[model samples]
Each structure stands twice: as C-alpha cells, then as structure tokens.
Target chain A: MSKEFFTIGALLYKDYDLIDVNATLRLLGSLKDNFNIITITQTGEHVKSYTPQVANYINYNFENCPDFDILFIPGGIGTKYELENPVFLDFIKERAPRVKYVLTVCTGSGLVAKTGLLDGKKATTNKQFWDWMTSNGPNVLWVKKARWVVDGKFYTSSGVSAGMDMALGFISDVFGREAADEIAITAEYEWHDNPHWDPFAERIFGKNI
Target chain B: MSKEFFTIGALLYKDYDLIDVNATLRLLGSLKDNFNIITITQTGEHVKSYTPQVANYINYNFENCPDFDILFIPGGIGTKYELENPVFLDFIKERAPRVKYVLTVCTGSGLVAKTGLLDGKKATTNKQFWDWMTSNGPNVLWVKKARWVVDGKFYTSSGVSAGMDMALGFISDVFGREAADEIAITAEYEWHDNPHWDPFAERIFGKNI
Candidate 1:
C-alpha cells in the first residue's frame, strides 16, 4: 500500500441505513489499495440499524478520530432523530469542512444539511422523502432529478441504491473514468453514468428540478 | 405481521460480501411486515466482512437453528476458502432442502452450487470470475447472460449489485408484480424487469445463454 492512500471516515449511528452504509463501504473497500476506510460513531459502540441489524463496533469516536480525506454519511429513519442531536451536528460541522469530499446517501443529506456546509450549494436527497429533506437546508438549491449532485467537494445522492451510483461517480472523479468503469465491470454493476438521469426524482417531483 | 409470515435466514460468515448481504436485507426488510429476517453464522458470533465491517451478532448456529422459508447466501473472497470447509458444506446441505426458497448472490452461487442443489438446474454467477465460478458446479447448466435465474425454488443472481435485481424478481414471484413494482417505486429503483437483458453477460460471454 502507498503511504499517501486516501482515508475515508464513514459516520455510523443508530438507525443508519444499512444498505447505504454497506454499499458505499463495499465500493470503496474494493479500492482498498488506494483507500484506508474507517467506521466512526458518536461513541464507538455497537449501533443498531433500522433493519434491527447491529453493527459490532465502530473504529473511532469524535474525540479520538483521525483526519480523513473523505467523509461518508448515510441516511435512514434515524436521521429524523439524529437531526436534533447536537453532538452529531457538531461532529459533522467539525469534520466536513476539512475533508476533500463530503459524501451523503439517502436522507443522510438531511443530516449533512444541518451542518450548514451545504448552504448555497447544489445537492439532493432521497426522493421518497423529498419534501421533508428539502426543508432541512432551505438555502441549498436541491436538484430534483439527479442520481447524485456534485458541487465542489460535496456529493449527495438520491435514495438507497443510488448511493452505489454516486460512489461510482466519486471513483470516476478521483481515479478517472477508466478506473471507475473497470470497477463497475468487475462488480458487474450497470453504472448510471449520468448524474442527471434519475427517474425516481422525476417520478416523485413530477419534473426534474 | 401475519402468523404465517415467511422467515428468511441469512447466512453470515467471516468475509461475506457485505453489499450482496445488505442489499438483499434492505429490500426484504422493507417488506418486514410480510417477513421475519434473521442472521445466522457457524457459531452465532459477530462476523467480520472482507471489508472489515463487523456484524454485531448472528441469531443462530447450526445446532439450534430454526426452519426457514428462505435461505440467503451471500458470496465474497472468503468463499474461496469456505468452499473447502466440510462444516460449511454440511450446514448448507442440511438447511437448503427444507427451505421453500434458496437465494444465492454473486459468488454465493458458487457456494450453493457446491451443495449439488444446482446440479441439473440452470443458474448464473459473477461474470468477472466466470471461468472459476463455472468450474464449481460443472453439471449445472450455467447461464452466461442473466441478471438472475429461477429454477423451481432456487434463485441465483449474476453478481454483487445484481443481487438487488434478483431479490426484486423473487418478490415479484412471491408477492405479485404490483407488490414488487410498488417496492421498486418506493426505493426509486429501475427494476430490470427482464432477466434476459443482462448486458454484462452479453459483454462477457457473448449472447444471452
């Protein structure tokens, strides 16, 4: 492994979407030779997901976390509750700005939106809960028809499976399109290459915003 | 939930493919009202994935396991080692015959193929490792171009992300298209309705087998 490999810190909390978290990890972990991945939680304890699946232990807590080049956050039914958590918001506020990439999946955008970093930026969230998600960051220009939105360093994706698409895009941005396409082929994933070709957003919002 | 709700026992082992496992869990879990999901391992301990993510704890071990309506087996790099373990093979042999549905994702088809359940039946596996996967169950007619295959009670998907597509197909088979389509709509997933339209298989093996 190279000494300069990128580090990605994934946020973990109770009720975090298991699919969003795992899919992103699987994609990034496949590039393990180039990335050092760590799972971080509020307290570094075992967290229970909405599926009721328990994740054994997190790698770090806010107080002892290392600097990361990327921050990955996943959204779930728990985001509705985590939004009110000052510790969670504080952690995001502190770490997001320092990371080269701030990636969010599903309603995870809602939590990231609370950090104020998304203010005045273009972003998107899980379309199934669009109205509620949009309300979180009123100042942000939310793209209604995007598999994912990339503005500066922030990458926000729509819904659960869409996270995989966003991660592929992120890989393309970081490693080049050929690398991303190669990874997609190895995983046999039909990469939704265009960020704006989201049918879910079209179905939910009536028009692609 | 109904008294007769189907129970899906998902096999969890060290280095299991987290994406394949979690994607299926998320889709079926969304239908939790109609299913009871449980995670099982060899010794019922917390299992670490190839990505080094920790699953808190499994529900049952081989000795005290419950009869399942469906058995979900996810594949990973660990499978290369697990295929040689007699205990793992015996466990699958004991549980698979009694289950109403047997679901295998990615190289998981390789593991299920070892059970001999797929012998004389048509199935598919991860296309990137096609030659190696095909060698596992030579007598089984392997489909080269398939998002998923359904041979009676068995459902085998092409690769990692393809598992999500196969699970949707399984849902459609068991709960009508309306139910499956509704779930797909909620997840904002473009369910590849036709299993035969697998471009990966076409690209790799030439023509749909």
Candidate 2:
C-alpha cells in the first residue's frame, strides 16, 4: 500500500519445480500496474527445472540483486541442497524481515524454515514429501491439512499447482476477491479458493480424497 | 509404442501461453521413460511468455528441428502473427500427419486451423476469443461446448488451463486412466475429470460457471 507498485524478487535455484514458479508468478504478474516481477538465481546466469527440464533466464545474480517489496521463494528438489549455503541462507536472513510479504511455494518453506524465520509461525509444504516438510522446520508449526497456511506476512503453499491457488489468495488480499475470481476465471482454473481443505493432506493421512 | 520413448516436439512461438505449455507438458515430461520433450521455436534461441515475462530456452529452430512422436502446439497472443508464415504452416502440415498425436492448446487451434489440416476435424479453442476461433477455421466442426475435442489423431483444448486437462486425457489414452489420475494427484492439481462438460465454454456463452 505504501509503494505505487510492489517489486517481487523471485529466488530460484536449479531443479526448481517449473509449475510452482511459473503458474503462481504468472497470476501475480497479470496485474501489470500493481506488480513488477524479476528472477534471481544464487550464482548462475540460468537455471533448469527438475522435470521436463525447462531453462529459465535469470534476471540478477544474488550479489547485485535489487531490493524488493515481496520475496517470492519457490520450492524444488534443489532447495535442500542449498540449506547450508552461507550466502543463500544469509540472503534470506537479511531480506525476509525487510519485505512486506514473503510468499513461498512448496519446498520454499523448507528454505525459509532452515533460516529459522518461520520458527514459531504456521506453514505447510508439498504433502507428498511430508517427511521432508516435517524435517525442515522442527520449531515451526507445520499444518498438514491445509492447501496453504498464512501466519502473518509469511504464506506457504502445499505443492506444485497449489502455488497458483495461494497466489490468487495473495492477489485477493492485495487486490480484491473480485480480482482473484476474475483471474481464476480467466485462467480457466478450478481454483480451490479454500485454503484449509486439502485433499492431498487427507489422502496422505489415510483419509478419503 | 514402436519406439523406446515417445519423443515430444513442442512447437512454441513468441509470447506462447506459459501455463499452457509448462503445466500440460510438465506432467507429460514427468513420465521420463515414456516421454522425451523438446522445445521448437520459430527462429529464436529464446522466447518470452506474454506476462510475468518468463524466458524459454529454445532447443531447435524451424529449419533444423527434429521429428518426434507427438507434436505439441501452444497458443498465445503471438500465434496469430504466424498464421501466414509458410515455414510454420509447413512444419505443422508436414509433422501433424506423420506424428502419432497432435496436441494443441488454447489459441493453438487458430494456428493449426490456418494450415487446413483441421478443416474437417472436430476442434475446440479458447472460448474467450470466439471470433478468432471461428474465423481461423470455417470448415472445421468447432465445438463450443467441449473443454477439449479429440477427432481422429487431432486433440484441441478449449483454453489456457484446459490444456492441462486435455494432456491428462492424452495420458489416459496412451497409458491408462490410473496413470492419468496418479499424475493429477502428484501435481496436486484439481483435475476436471469430465472434459465433456466445459464450464468456461458455458460461462463464455452466458451461463453460470
């Protein structure tokens, strides 16, 4: 609300889930006047996603990255590898508190959790990797039955396509419900508007899908 | 079935729908042993999506593109510009018939329609642009009620997110219903199981979604 347009710094790494970044960010980027999006890779000029192997063009390296209003963290098979990375962890530690909102998709919570940023906050991640989710944030309250969890400025989604739904929630919070619905309708997406009901979680916990 | 792996030659132009290509193909690409996906652009080393400005690394250009088992076509604001390009049209005309299956997403039907291969085939495209769909292929049996149409070897989806549903249908056709369902579950996607009932189409035609 303070800025004319929110600047989003999307931190991506090798083997990141393709849909997690694109589908979610695509919706946020739809509101051109309200958001400015950019991609940042730790040290590489480019990064390749885990499966189907799509290459992404990196906007800025970590060293020269611009300050952003929102920090967009995407989960991947790759984030686990960067857990102990001093520069990566340092970057999150430094920037997470300054940003107005921190939106994470899937294993992105894993990264932020490792930084001890979500120590007492509620979060969630890819239900398929429930063990990975639990292991990442020992001190954090991890909700297993939600499509996404929002505790203060941090929002974490379940997995893959759930990111898009979470992004819509963000849009609804920043923009309006009408704006979110219009986007979901335009995308032709069957938006799971409810953040609490997660079929993946239910199925994982031996309940009916 | 003859080959060890099904090679997918994805034809993408500038400003091609990001989610249409990534979301649909990402699932296909998930079955690593069954699929071999590659990007084919129209004379560019890299192509950018319409919004969120994601850049795609092109594998091969039109002149020296490789032949594959399936031909993937994605629609965007950019496809309309290539309607008359001989090489693009020729690529479709040549490969479409030779391939086992030809899958098109959103406005991709518009590009393929111009090539005249879909003249007598039952096709569907993005319902948002009804005029563009109708104008591109007058002779084609354009279905306004379906999310996706499968006529012979040609498969055309209604619009952006509909592509993911159509791709799952393709998986079910090639693999099995169980295989498609598993992928949908893994992606954590809210799969629209029934393609015959397209709410987007109905909504566009003045019905409730």
Candidate 3:
C-alpha cells in the first residue's frame, strides 16, 4: 500500500527473547523504505523481554493486525506458555499459510511446530533446546548441523543472535548476495553466509547426539 | 543492589539507532544475573528507533536515573540534534567521569566528543559517517583501522554491530576470555576478539586515503 514496502508482522509475548527478535529485524529494517516492521502482541500493548527487563510497545493485536507479507516468531522462556496457547497457535495456523514468508528464530520453530504448520517441514532451532523443539514436531525433518533451514516459505534458524545471520541469508535469497553483503558491511557485522557453517551443534549436543 | 549486578545506563532519544543499542546489550544481557540494564529517556516514557517504525519503553528519565557502572551511547539521525543539546551533553560529561566504563557505538562517539569527554582520547565511529563524527571531536584522536578503540574506560566502536564485538571484549576485560567465549558460543555468534580486526576501514575508505 505504502510505496512497495513489504509488511513484516513481528509477534511478541511475555518473556520473549530480545536478541532473537531484534537481530533479525535490524537487517530487515536496514532496507527501511522497502520493509515495514510492526510489533504484534495479544494485548496490543507492551511486553517485557525474557531478561534485562526490556519492554517493546506493541502496535497490533492478533485480531486487528494488518495483512503482512512475512510472519515472524521469536522464541524465549515465555514460549513455554505460548506453545500451549490455542489462540496463539490458531492465529499462526490460520495466518502462516497465507503469508508470503514465515520465519522463526531459535525455539520459535517449536511454537510453529505446535500449530502443525512445521509438520513434515525441514527446520532447525536453537540448539540449547534441541530435544524439546524437535520432539514438538515428530514429523518435521530436523537438521542439526545447520545455522538455518529454509523450506519453501518457512525459514527457521538457530539461537538468539543466529537470527541476524539467518536474516542476512534470507536477504541474500530474496534480494541478492550483493545487497546482503552491503547491509552486513554497513552494519560492520561479519556475515557467516554459509548456512552449513554451524559449530554449535556438535559443541552443544556432544560428538554424536 | 540486587545480587552483584552492575548497572548500565542506556540513553535514549527520539531516533536512536536500534541495532547499535541492542547488539551490545544483547551480549551483556546474556549474563543477565551479572548486569542490570536500564533505559534512560528525556521524559521517562518511550523513544522511537531510527528505522522501520519501532519504539522502546523507558525505565528512567535524566532527572531520576541512578548511578551506573557503565554508560552507553548509541548514534542515529536524532544525534544531529542531540549533539547540540546542552542537557544531553552535560549529563554525559558529569556521569562519564564517575563510571567504570563508557562505551559509544558509531556516531555516539560524536555525542561524547561534543561533551569533550573524548577529547585527546583514541576513538572510532561508523566508517560511512567518519568525516562528520571526526569533525565533532577536533581534539580526539580517531583511529581508522579498528573494530573498536579502547583507551582507558572509553570503548568507542566502529559501527552498529561492532558494538557486540566491543561488548565481548569488555566482558573479556572485566570477567575473562573464557566467560566471553562461553557467552558467544551460547548465542551462536562469532566473536571478533581482536579489537583491531576491522576490514571496514580499507573497504569503506580506500587504501592510502
């Protein structure tokens, strides 16, 4: 509607991981005029992060949130409660299929998994909570040694800050490698462009687990 | 205080850089129990980020903000106006001397420079806005080839995400390298440990410039 900007709906809940949410959005927001990022919460108010006592002001409730091209879900300790929420799951289940892209950071995949959207989908999540997340979707093809896994419109990534790298990769996918590289360079961030360049899997899950 | 947590006073204005503020805080916040981060705004209400329309709820105002162990300043388009505001400059000038560490990301160094806090000290700023930031600090010695510059308590980093590397370096300085490494691994982020490992200098500004 406004220019040709793609609307990105960023869902928030109590105790949501701050870094997981911001890191990804920073890259997307870098293309400012090309993207419109909005904060979505159940109450359409403010929600505190998992730690450090940071809060984000929400712009929309699930019922009133405008149609978005991309749907973003970030994971945190609050996700333990959110995963069981029928309203949360139902909202995602109903909206995700209609979105152009659905992205989940960290254990956010588990939230999507609970909605049955990630069933039979290839995905990867925060390695720290690997067992819990993988078990949530028994039918989903879980890849361990991946920074992120992209299957069709569903893009799932590893832990908190890993979302930034995955966002850059997503940018590379939709835009070009040059555009992604330019953003990373402008931000003075090193782009781990290779999706297979994950050392945390073996380091966290042990040699063979 | 509650436990042995170090307090961080984060200054916010109308259009502060979001990534520059959040990236460093994410790393420091990872060690949640050890640090207490507080947002300080002009009116103790909320501040918007320079981006795709985002905002942050504030914790304290300039008049009520408590003593902090570390003082953090981030740059943005709003900084163009903040540089001339005496209240902003006066607060930083007064508090910076008593703080254990003063970290400035990107053109945030320009704000500190205007306060004369960084005068005759080694500092760095965003490569893209190098000329503008350096011009603000006539007496400050600016380094071109640095991911970050640490001259005493002042940690002035290159740009947005370079603040994360500086934060890790600060962690290694305060805690230990092992602790910083552990945090990095947990976040699934690659830490650029070396303070002088900045390729952006040569990239943004050609060699022999």
Q: Candidate 2 chain B: worst 10 consecutive residues by lDDT?
A: B1-10
Q: Estimate the Cα RMSD of every predicted model relative to the unseen true structure.
A: 2.3, 2.4, 2.4
Per-residue accuracy of model 1 over B177-200 as CA lDDT, tens digit each? 887788777776778888886888
Give one digit per residue, the lDDT tens place, for model 2 in B7-34: 8888988778878888888877767678
Best by lDDT: 3
Candidate 2: give the clashing pairs: none
TM-score of B-chain for each predicted structure, in order: 0.93, 0.94, 0.94
Give the residue spans of candidate 2 off by over 4 A: A1-4, A207-209, B1-4, B206-209
TM-score of chain A of 3: 0.95
TM-score-based ranking, best first? 3, 2, 1
DockQ order of candidates, top first: 3, 2, 1
Q: Model 1: residues >4 Å from true position, as ranges?
A: A1-4, A52-57, B1-4, B52-57
The alpha-carbon lDDT assigned to residue B148 of candidate 3 equals 91
**Per-residue accuracy of model 1 over A120-168 as CA lDDT, tens digit each:** 9999999889889889899999988889999999999999888988988
TM-score, prediction 2 = 0.94
**Superior candidate under DockQ, 1 versus 3:** 3
Each model's DockQ score: 0.56, 0.65, 0.73
